[model samples]
Target: MKQDIDIPKVEGVYVAIVNEYNDIYKTQDWNAYIINDNDDALEMVIIVTDGYSEDKITSKFRKKIDVLPKKSYAKIELMQEELFAVNNQFKVTYFKGNTMYDKVYTFRKNTINLKALQPVPLMEARGVLVK
Candidate 1:
């Protein structure tokens, strides 16, 4: 009789850290479908929270961060010398490719915006990073 050799299991966790606007709890591709020329139909949502174990966060949200919508564009401002934790507070500014000429705004750390001020165009968003 042939027997399978059992290997020891190693416990671990997986994580991905993104600056400012994080789409870790959603699965919609809100970034790819919008055009910069239009701002009214902008239904962009963004979330920023303290980082956690991938398995834990995924299960709580019932989805993978990969399914989360990518930012159309992001303006990241590093808070400290390093980004050590998901909860580490940092300022962020973003644009969805339609409203306000793509000007970025500083949002409170550890929070999210279910919508943007407007849909901003890519071209308009390019030079509008107000820092």
Candidate 2:
């Protein structure tokens, strides 16, 4: 048996982006986890699991900071040092019925776009990685 773990409650935000070009059978969904929120900015983390299709590909960079109240569509660049230094390690794992795949990616600086500022159900909304 595994012991239960208590995770600290950190103020954060949840953002979800839907690809405009998704077809009926397959819809592309991208999520951004922005934790440690403050007045001016929030810590953003993006994790991607599937890369078999162009619409499903995502960057492995972590710990990005996006200034709040940004312009409707602006680009924010992320640095590797800042991402990894914050104790964030890029990890990916996928499991099928009888097969499992796991991989780790090298840290690389990347940029993500802030799509818009909108209202989310229960948290602050910060749209990112709009394609």
**Most lDDT-accurate candidate:** 2
Model 2 superposed RMSD (Cα): 15.2
By TM-score, the best candidate is 2
How many residue pairs collide in each prediction? 14, 0
Q: Candidate 1: how many backbone clashes?
A: 14
lDDT of each: 0.26, 0.30
- Which segments of candidate 1 are over 4 A away from where they belong? 1-42, 52-72, 85-131
Candidate 2 stretches greater than 4 Å from native: 1-8, 21-40, 43-59, 69-131
lDDT string, candidate 1, 77-130, tens digits: 223312222233222212333321222123233322233323233423212111
For 13-121, candidate 2 gives per-residue lDDT tens digits of 2222212323664643334332222333321323342222223334444333333331222222222222322222233332222333333332222222233434433
TM-score of each: 0.18, 0.23
Residue 14, candidate 2: alpha-carbon lDDT: 28
